[model samples]
Target: MENNTQTTIFGLRAIIEAIESGSTINKVYLQKGLRGDIFYQLDKLIKINKITTSMVPVEKLDRLSKNKNHQGAVAQISPIEFHDLEKLIEETTNQNTIPLFLLLDQISDVRNFGAIIRTAECTGVHGIIIQQNGSAPVNAETIKTSAGAAFKVPICKVNHIKDALFLLQAEGIKTVAATEKTEDSVYDIDLNQPLAIIMGSEHRGINPSVLKMVDYKAKLPLLGAIESLNVSVACGVLLYESVRQRL
Candidate 1:
């Protein structure tokens, strides 16, 4: 997140003011089947602002609003602006350090994504790559979960993760996929160099097709009875291992 703007705004008047005040509204949710003068004004402003919007049920608005009196509409204001991957790479390459990147494979949990971003920022990761469609929305809950680190990290949303992986590969970045199927531990890989690690969703793990394209596949050692670690915790462990190695 790059700005000081609050992550959410509710109420039609407040939303209209947000638009008038030049706030960056990421997505707008309008209650389905609502029609009135105020609603009309908000809709007009939303259209004039060209904001991304969705017509959803009132229950959806209630969920997004956290049961607040939303008055049939809610808007999410993004605190961080998503970066262009190419430009971010160019800038990172110019920094003269081994660029560390994180590629999230279909992670839809907002808190998990935010936790990962917080860890990545703390560990000095250059940027994060997420799928444009399936990735979680960076909302107020995500911001709160990250402890505001979402504003500090650079993130890129790509149409397809493969294309971004190929681009990174062309840049000589070693793509590491974290999976439980691998015999290799995190210690086996030299993460000190420019590299990107693929951390996937808890249920599906990394995409098998993506698994085929990675340069290395590694996993965290599990000595206890638990079958798997939370994706956010696993991401932090991997990032810190790299951090330790680089230091």
Candidate 2:
């Protein structure tokens, strides 16, 4: 991650906003299934909001905290501000932008996110969209992993990725998902067209909901022993192919 990226966000009000705003939070450490109105509200919100959570003992919270009465909870926020999908798309179109966009469905690794941003910037991707929850925070580690590319690229966080995809499709931009199950290599596809490439979490691949909505699902040819490439590397492969075709 980059040196300037934020690693910790404390205080009760800060934690509440991080949860409610759908920021890319890696995890929430609570004081071990705590019982109280505030704690209970946080817990209820955590479950209802679908934020990844961990109930840790007080000792663990102590280690994570500054030892200054943390009220049984702490939340970590990424340094970067998440972009809005519709706004980004609209801005590009209204500006007559020749756009290349990337959509990530639940990728949780900061390093991978950083790497992909580096690659996206290199390939001229207009922006990258990630789900606010279940995605990696743009912490110091992510910025460092991206080798400073995270700052150069625009990142958008959304509550539901399906709606984002639908909006893109409505704008005449082809939505493509990279999946191993497909027979077509990205090379076989036409990247010259205005397109949005979708990648999934390293473990799950693209979400089933997002995958079904894609205009086309393409896969990279696996000619070697390795079953697959890392999501970031796979993204580079697919994206550069688009760049190649466009050139």
Candidate 3:
């Protein structure tokens, strides 16, 4: 991703312009029940453009905008255009190296996303995979939270996470899901090989559809009553374990 590329669209007119320009928009937040010519125009444009739109409350928009007169709409544009799965696979294969990817299953926290990106880049993960729906929108907060790491990591957004996992399997990359249900810790896995790690959401663990697709399911060993670490922290632990194994 290009760090200098502007990716946020605020206000109704700007968002409309962004959509018409065919920018890779991650998602759109529209004020709930905002009916008018402007909104109808936007709805038409958004539908025709095939952009994902979410009807959010005014308070939600206000929180996202930091009260910056967002005018009831905001669009999260991709900092860099998302690459196709084939492109990512080809690039990895061309390098004659094992492909390493991090799959995020509905991680909604922007801070967690940022932290995970930071860890992923440092660990030499090839790419980060996220679902198009129910995932965090890559907006200004994400960029800020990532501390610019989002620009460094290659992020691929798929329509369905299961499809992405299937593609990874076809590419011969082992799909590993981090879950507390397993007795094995992430440290036990051999990350030196071509592999992808699935990190679940903070609230709900991994999705059922995703859990069923993983080649292996492992957990981080915890002796304390705390039970689990923060999702971002857990990501760091698991990713760094892969790094350690690779080294």
Best by TM-score: 2
Model 3 Cα lDDT, one tens digit per residue, 1-247? 5665445667988888888876888788999878878878888998876678889999988887778888889877777667787788778867967788999999998888888888888888889998877888676677777788788788888877898898889988899999997877777778788999999999998998788889899898888989888999998888888878877
- Candidates by lDDT, descending order: 1, 3, 2
Candidate-wise lDDT, in order: 0.88, 0.81, 0.84
Pairs in steric clash, model 3: none
Which residue pairs in candidate 1 collide? Answer: 1-80, 1-150, 1-151
Residue 19 of model 3: what lDDT? 80
Best by lDDT: 1
lDDT of 2 by residue, 1-247 (tens): 2325676766566787777876656568887657777777777777776666777788877777878677788777667666778888887766655678999998888889888988988888888998867888777788888888887788887787898888888888899899987888787787787799999999989888777788998999888999999998999999888988887
Candidate 1 has its poorest 10 consecutive residues by lDDT at 1-10
Q: Write the per-residue lDDT of candidate 1 for residues 1-247, one digit (tens) a residue.
A: 4656457779899899988987667788999999999999999988776666889999999898999999999998877677889988888878979999999998989999889989999999999998765678777778889888888888887877897899898888899999998899999999999999999886899988999999999999999999999999999999999999999
Q: List TM-scores for all candidates, in order.
A: 0.78, 0.87, 0.86
C-alpha RMSD (angstroms) for model 2: 2.9
Error of 3 at 145 (Å): 2.9
